[model samples]
Target chain A: MGIKQLAKLLADEAPECIKEVPLKSLQGRKIAIDASMSIYQFMIAVRQGGSNNPAAMLTNADGEPTSHVQGFFTRTIRYMSEGIKPVYVFDGKPPNIKSGELVKRREKREKAEKELAAAKEAGNIEEQDKQAKRLVRAGTKENNDCKKLLELMGIPVVNAPCEAEAEASALCKNGEVWAVGTEDMDALTFGCPVLLRKMTFAKSGKENIQQMNYKKAIEGLNLTHDQFVDLCILLGCDYCDSIKGIGPKKALAFIREYGCIEKILENLDRKKFTVPDDWVPNEKKAKEAEEKEEAEYDTDEEKEKTGKPKSDADEEDTEEEVVPIYVKARKLFNEHEVITNLDLKWKECQVEALTKYLVDEMGFNPDRVKSNIEKLQKAQKANTKPQSRMDSFFKPLPSKAGAKKPAKATVGSKRKANDTKGKKGAFFKKR
Target chain B: MFEARLTQGKIFKQLIEALKDLVQDANIDCSEDELSIQAMDSSHVSLVQVNLQAGGFDHFRCDRTISLGFNSTNMSKILKCAGNDDVITLKAEDTADALTLMFESPGQDRIADFELKLMDIDAEPLGIPDTEYQCTIRMPSGEFQRIIRDLQVLGDTCVISCTKEGVRFSVSGDLGTGNVLLRNNAAEKEEDQVIIEMEEPVELTFALRYLNFFTKATSLGGSVILSMSPEVPVVVEYPIEEFGHIKYYLAPKIDDDA
Candidate 1:
């Protein structure tokens, strides 16, 4: 759950921050798409049959999962036809801070696997369908498959150093893309200038493309970017545990009042909030030494079981540090590792190779592949012409700061104002 | 064990009604002397603190101090089951997961018992420093409620200015500006009096939205107290005769346009 209930909170509290734009409006924009998130969605949505049928994972002849390819291929074609240049960002190694969350996900997957087996044994179709969806994991294979597919289509694919969302946000910040496209709200926490949600939506006509303006959001909420990130962390993020009782509304209040997690934690009542035991960041060097000792001690048993050398085990142990999860989480949000100096160039789709790869290797229908290839070529041809927006014709002038300055200035002096106000004998300072 | 019985059960019911909309969950701290609660509204823009003295209850017993956390909405639902004249008895163990509420009708012919699940509410107990207000304006609770309600129609924020002459509540919106002034009126009925005691003049602006919510306590008191100092949160108090008072603290909106 990336910033749980964030969309609702934004809609409720800062309606001006989100815009519902028609798909056609994005005609000449480059969007850095979170590949893993979309792939996972495809795995859930694209099944063997319709919704009424058994939700079996769609696979190629050799049982290789092809649902992601099927969904991604069609979606890319749709986006291309709309003249939207898509840059797919794939996840590399996740940050060490995410290990706990990954472990929890793995445990959940295992439990779902067991439940699926039980449901299969019981012949409960509905239960099996539910468990199957829960078991979906976009692993390395899916990532590589999409990478190859996008490469064939000449759509740029960036393999992020840690997280795809961060990489996508970085690309947007670098002005390589107009927006970061994904359902995950954490991209905003990573400071993506613009975040587009429901971009992967099937044309059901029920939903509109939600464009969230980061600047407008912070301005409307009266928060600095750092404070916004703190609010996201408080709401709930993948890299660390959130305080149990604080929901979205309360989290925003805390962030607004205290400014940062450190100040909030400093002032929080432990009896009420129940801060975790290991809330502080651990000493890295000490933790590694301790883990290395444990690894050395476990070597005898490892040697007896798998003939693995003590040196190899020690090397593996050395890599795992005991940094407090939230600290690492915040660091990742602020300064995630990405290939910053990226040279992105969208080229003509290799139609022949794409058709052969999709139709022959992926077992896609030949006629459908051919038609999509044609559509892609048509979109590419249309995109080659210089697309000039209204702003491109004129030099942008400095925005009038008169209206915004007073609001910001007042916010800056609010704490001080309150402090002096409390000095007056009649004032009641309600905590 | 902890138990407190109130003869007028409607007070408890009305109290829940006043609090439920503003607060979602809170802990009711019961001691030998009094039962108290201190909670900030979900937005933290305002706070509601309640204090009910033990002596005011028909019967009160507390072997040890206990904190009972509950969802105010759920609490309201449970309280709604009691009749207005019912004698409400609240009981809980020293370390309880739920609080038991037993309500007996005045006729003693009907009785209802509700066990409300306790929540682990994580809220810091805010320390409210005592202050002698620069100005204290006391007016009929109904009148105060009407002013807040009427001003809400005019604007989002209400500007309240108190002077030696009288107190003024003013609001300006896109449509127009509205101002209501109340001078010191010593009516035959004490509750109808508009009384103001001031050392210095002060003007403050507050969000009328929250002030309107605070007015839900109008039925609980005959008069409402408005205490204020410059640049600080104004305290709105509704006294529950012989028992306690429900106080709301709302910070004034720092005028950015000013």
Candidate 2:
């Protein structure tokens, strides 16, 4: 039945009972939660106590675990107790392309943390001083515990290969989940069948709980899900950072008529559009490669028969093995460091050994290791073997004391001097 | 279960004004057609609960139970610029974390997008003792708001004395004393004032600020019902259509001198 018909049926005969639907109906439902979104919410609600400020220690003066615990459990339990079982997803390692964004964020947080520490040290307290507490609350054990508790409650959780919300949306499209529950509109672009707003325990008594069906919601936008996906790509999703000057409403208009990402790009009046330089297929390829590497590392096993060491060359033989660029990149950097430090020549076997060590001993994520190995391989490919400046630069120099000084040719020794002149010219010219 | 889309602006405007001054963070409990918010202030001196009926909104529709995480601050901001009469549409975005509050005014149109951020606010179960109150009074909401406003001018503390004769609200400060005494249906009064009498004497002191904020909310409705004991906090309740009731509780002032 359509949602309206169902809502009507329930509303007329059994309003009270329908409101109390068991949480199980939510099972396998995709919930798109912002990984970094609710940290401030926790800080504001969680009580503080003791020096360590452990999650368990966080309680009100009356000894009640305050809003943080309340917000987490009430919503989680309410959903579970009802039939709408949820798939709780968390974020995993981000692609390197996002490093710049991450770097900027880290810098901002560091500055804020420093100011907060200073304020506490100086004891210049104000209501705004809560901002300091907010920072400490940002990445804390309490939040992690909440996620863990949800998992222990038997909710399916995906450590999303990337953005938790985006991955959750993928699940929605796959029909693994009926709808996505989150506060972010970014999910709409991810193409979920339905997006539920105001779905919480707090507004349970309100007359109407607002829900939007994706098909109806996007009616005016006139864009198919694929086009909408491109719109988000243009606007920027976790996959690709957003293009400047494009937001939800504007991107919707652009993609609705264009029909596809390629059509929009082609039809765009050059003067009106400024595509971000970094928004290209290669960047997406790089990200995909990086994700492949991470997933491989998550499920890596060492085989016994290869006592001679299985190089990435062996990995290349595997059908699904996606070589990561970072693996080779790390080796190239290390080789540079070794050559610069010890003035040694590049050794292929040593690079391979380091890659193996990183994978086996260091327990580096295979995806990450593969990427670094690929980077080193690329560097090796770019340079001519044994002929590049790096190769000769790494060659050991003869020690001053070990070499005999050539006997100074007597100025009048014509026969020996003529032979030496030709030889010296040839060597010096080549150098 | 029952979905009606409200297109009138006045309803939204009135609703926003009614909700603005109340405590921003409160857990509203709802059952079927009834919704209530219960919260005590930091001092435990005052508590306020706002109730509204299911029919209060134009598009009142709910079949299944849902609890919304609403921030009074955000809602107030959205309601601020709304005209007294405007058409607004309220719709659920899905079974998720968003609600669309759309306003269509004469020259301007706007949509206030709100997402309920999950908060970890815990509600402790409070056991309220059931007792026979010494005094119960029904007063006109306008007069109540004025009494609170006037007493606030005197000082932070006020004494509310109710007797068989009438209800007396007085405040004494270094400057002077301010009192508003009204016998049941006395003289010419504003349409908003309707005074009632008590069967017995009940007197208590309370903070004026709490009283001021709490009583001002009575303006949203026609009248307020008050139940009180001399030593305990007062309970002020506003009953609205559709089984919605807003109640405020103000604790008695502790006598430092005594």
Candidate 3:
């Protein structure tokens, strides 16, 4: 559903932009991972018979299933051991427009649940296992548990105001993270400079992960970044239905030939072709805004601030007016919020509090927890040399938003700094 | 209160490798004269017994018979770091919840030591009855391992047809069908081939994966003895030289259960 077939099309067309890199080789780099995606993955692993009944998975003294806790704990330790400091970005409330996708997913899960019941009745063990995987859901409880565990492990958890991937991409664009780690290529459409996929240790038979460099992809497509987003929207995105008969290949050719979806729609047969209501021509004002030549001589800092997802900039101009829906979708991507000025400074682990959180409360084996903690300490001593990451965050943004200039970031004030950015009035009002 | 030292670390390493996959956790019972561990796989479909006499170790001492619970997989991982030539010592205080393992090279240089915490797992010992089986066939352990490995590609369950003639292992699935016949040959020069003793012909279908899992102990023994009766579980035994023996009992997969 995320720009259907976009990754496959890119794989075939722009092979050079995708480079395989080992997880260990990502040492000394900070990666922004989509936390909800990782939590959901671990939740599914727990649900679909993670050797659940026979051998208890990582639990605490209360014997509560800490699949997310264990997964985050182990993975954080493993990554930090390899010298890859991580900032886990979690999704906030989903965009209201994504209700359609959510409903569809729920229906699919319900259908799978019914199939699983039948499979269990029929004693089809294999079929039951497959169908059970679909019934798993990662809800608020799991997310909070993960946040606690990550904090215990001294990893930062960024709760995004919207999509985690969007927030991760935002972080990447700000040079706060080396890359965005997510399974979906939507980050590329959202303009993440670099995206990492399949960053798992026990992948079994999975092929090596390849990093997607966004700028290189645009170069390979021989189009501007805007045109590439338009291509993705044409191929279909989560926010809107794509134009009929326009897949990745057709969308690429149309953009190359006509330059944009609106232009391509103009030359098409009215009865034979179709696009989303917003994708079609809304009015002449939208067209006028397109030709208004953008401001020039942009430095890197300026570029970071103006990286206002395509949607934010367009919506800012047409605050009350309607534009193509893809413009709205792009604007939504632009408006999606991320944590900023975060004191992502990893701290020394508190084994006592960690033991209380995991072993005492959650019922994890105390011995295994102790052993893993020792491994973490060894990795920390041998690899991760502590340095200041807050310097870059506190360094004055000389170009824009001089209003919140605090000059320096105190560790205690980081929460306010992260949550205060992007519509503080609306955020508190809604809460 | 407890300490044991082995002349070579190879036995414990091999012991870990043998039962790591089948047994999740085990309770190692230590006494003055002998050390024993008895546990079953999580499903209770199989049981493993590891017995080591005090004489087997270079040094062994225990004031009281106490059980130490451990996760076998974790033990297996720790054992992987041991060198075959290293002399290993296991030490634990009476009230301690952790067991320390010290591995020293034969030359007394380069000593690596680590500790594993024990769990108070309430694992009860199952009383297994001794029953006379209709057939007991002894064959080279490698051959049995190979047969199971080869047929696992074909199906999940294999039928072990035992007759006065020999034992036949066969499996069929969507991939195709395969059959391996091991007829008794008294003149076989490999020491052990297919030795069959059948009161009457007995055929039982057992899960191939469990058999393959049980075969993880192939390094512990050179030959395998499979004993079966009309509808009973298949008893697979691997006899160790001076250490002890490990046995696995797998329930037959009934076609009716499908």
Candidate 4:
């Protein structure tokens, strides 16, 4: 997934970097949320009936799913009622390097679809429900519906060029947002200034939002920004496979000692670690290969187009060079394409229009929709004053014997409070 | 067209046997003077070069210079079909896609021919600079082979230290450490002597896995020569009788701890 179990690792090693804050403290602050991740969670969690008909999704009269709309609509109104400025960032086209992950997801969905049909034939209600949840994907239709709903609510929406977490982190880095709010731990690796988890809870007043400060985390771990990225890559990101024997603790130790993956790899005992066959290329060998390919530069297409006679060697040398995948992943984390100069202006909520779109067009209850719209209008009217900056509210908590103790409570609840059932590995049966 | 005849066919067979493990495919550049081959292993950590002068052949003729590309394993398989004392002739046209081999027994009563398919191998010629080494050691081929094989059992790498007094090969691993030292000795037979010539002392570490592969050429010569310098690849040379030699260039492993 995203730096597998990175939050736990950070909590155990650098608890001083994270702090628990009351949800009310986020008032008058701009938070950028990853819309695709939230929508996927809603599709997995929101269903019609409890035990008997778990496969029945919340749908309108035309039998189209309305669960994401219901969840996103209520969540947006809740944020507005708390005097919070929310900017929704939607995912764009995934990078080419993520094709392998996409293929795996597709294969899993197809297998689940077949299993679902068999369950339906056997009249096994529980099995059908499990298989149906495995098939839930936040595809184009759901994303478009969420975009339309956000625009109607007058919240600023950003279509990220790649991953939404990276773009949301960019927005936070540029000071346009106070923090990037998403459950994915890779927001830290994306270099977000402040990462807020448990922001999308279902009206839970007991659980406070967990805040992780990027600068403090780096200082506590005693690593540079580049070394932190290497640590995440080693802990297994989406782009490449990690070495067989390395886990989070060993990965952190190696980063601290060797300073980077290349050095760690050179000094590591191959007999002990048993590195992945195609994990990372030896730099010297890759350079020599590049030189050899450059010296024999003759394209088969050039021969065809220019009427030059093609030699047999041209066919043999046409195989492309192998560029290691981890290099691409590292580059992506360093420089993800986002709208750098953001003009995110939160506008007034169109009360009448939002009511009609939600209640009449989306088959929502008219009374509840009107009440939520009223709350949005009232909060906007009271927020006519300029919003406060993050630094004004957040003085780095004093590092005392008790300051680090608060992180354990928040991190412990944060781990168990992840109700997002559509987590990457949760759909498969554990071996 | 090109054709070359060799009286002792087994030499060619032994040459292929020495190279096939290190390189899969290579191009042999043939000139009026000699036949030369240069190729690096897939890992690029080691290189092998072979040079055979035309004067050493029983009969040699070449109108112009040409290059022949082949897979070493396939060439070795074809070479194995010849008898030990057979007269072997290699024939190929300028633009032919296959090389022709003919073998005749010593009595001239038995004759056989085989056609081996050629491949289009694209190899870049490396510019190997000729530099004077600091130390050169000449020892019996069997002694070098035994030392490499014995040290391989202890560790994956070997540190070679050469001085005016003698040369030492040392290795260490989880099991323990081992070292073998050889002093300068002049025996009655030239091949039995162990000689060391040095301008300055130099020590380098190399992966023993590749040295073990280089020892496959022990059957080609009575003695082996090792040339070493600082921050450079060591040259392991096995000289053939009067024709030329097969030299292996192995880059030393730089120990960051050292």
Q: What CAPRI-style quality would you assign to candidate 1? A: incorrect
Candidate 2 lDDT, B1-258, residue by residue in tens? 223344555544554455456455444433345444555443233455555565665556655443334556666666665555656654442233334566656555654433333221223224344566778777777778888887777776777888876888988876889988877774464444555656578887776776677765664567787787766667777665343566666656543210
After TM-score superposition, the amount by which residue A382's alpha carbon in candidate 1 deviates from its true location, in angstroms, is 1.0
Residue-by-residue lDDT tens digits, candidate 1, A377-403: 877765654232322222223332222
True contacts kept of each: 0.02, 0.00, 0.00, 0.00
The best-first sequence of candidates by TM-score reads 4, 1, 3, 2
Tens-place lDDT per residue, model 3, B9-125, is 888888888888887767777877777777766444456767788888889998765666788888877777779989989998765667889999999998899888776543446
Q: Estimate each model's TM-score.
A: 0.53, 0.35, 0.50, 0.53
DockQ of candidate 3 against the true complex: 0.01
Off by over 4 Å in 3: A46-64, A204-207, A276-322, A383-431, B1-258
Docking class of 3: incorrect
Please compute DockQ, using alpha carbons, for every candidate against the native two-chain complex: 0.01, 0.00, 0.01, 0.00
lDDT of each: 0.79, 0.48, 0.72, 0.78
Candidate 3 or 1, higher lDDT: 1
lDDT tens digits, residue span A1-431, model 3: 46689888887777656776556446556899999888877765643234423222344455566777778888788878766778899889877556657888999999998998998788777777778767767788889898888888777889887888888898899888889988878899888999998876656414466788998788878888778888887877788767786677888988999997657877877577765554543334445455774233222233244343443333334443344566656656555656665656676677888988877677778899999998887766534322212121122222223222222222112212212232322110110
Candidate 2 Cα misplacement greater than 4 A, ranges: A1-431, B1-22, B28-30, B93-95, B104-120, B125-132, B186-193, B241-243, B255-258
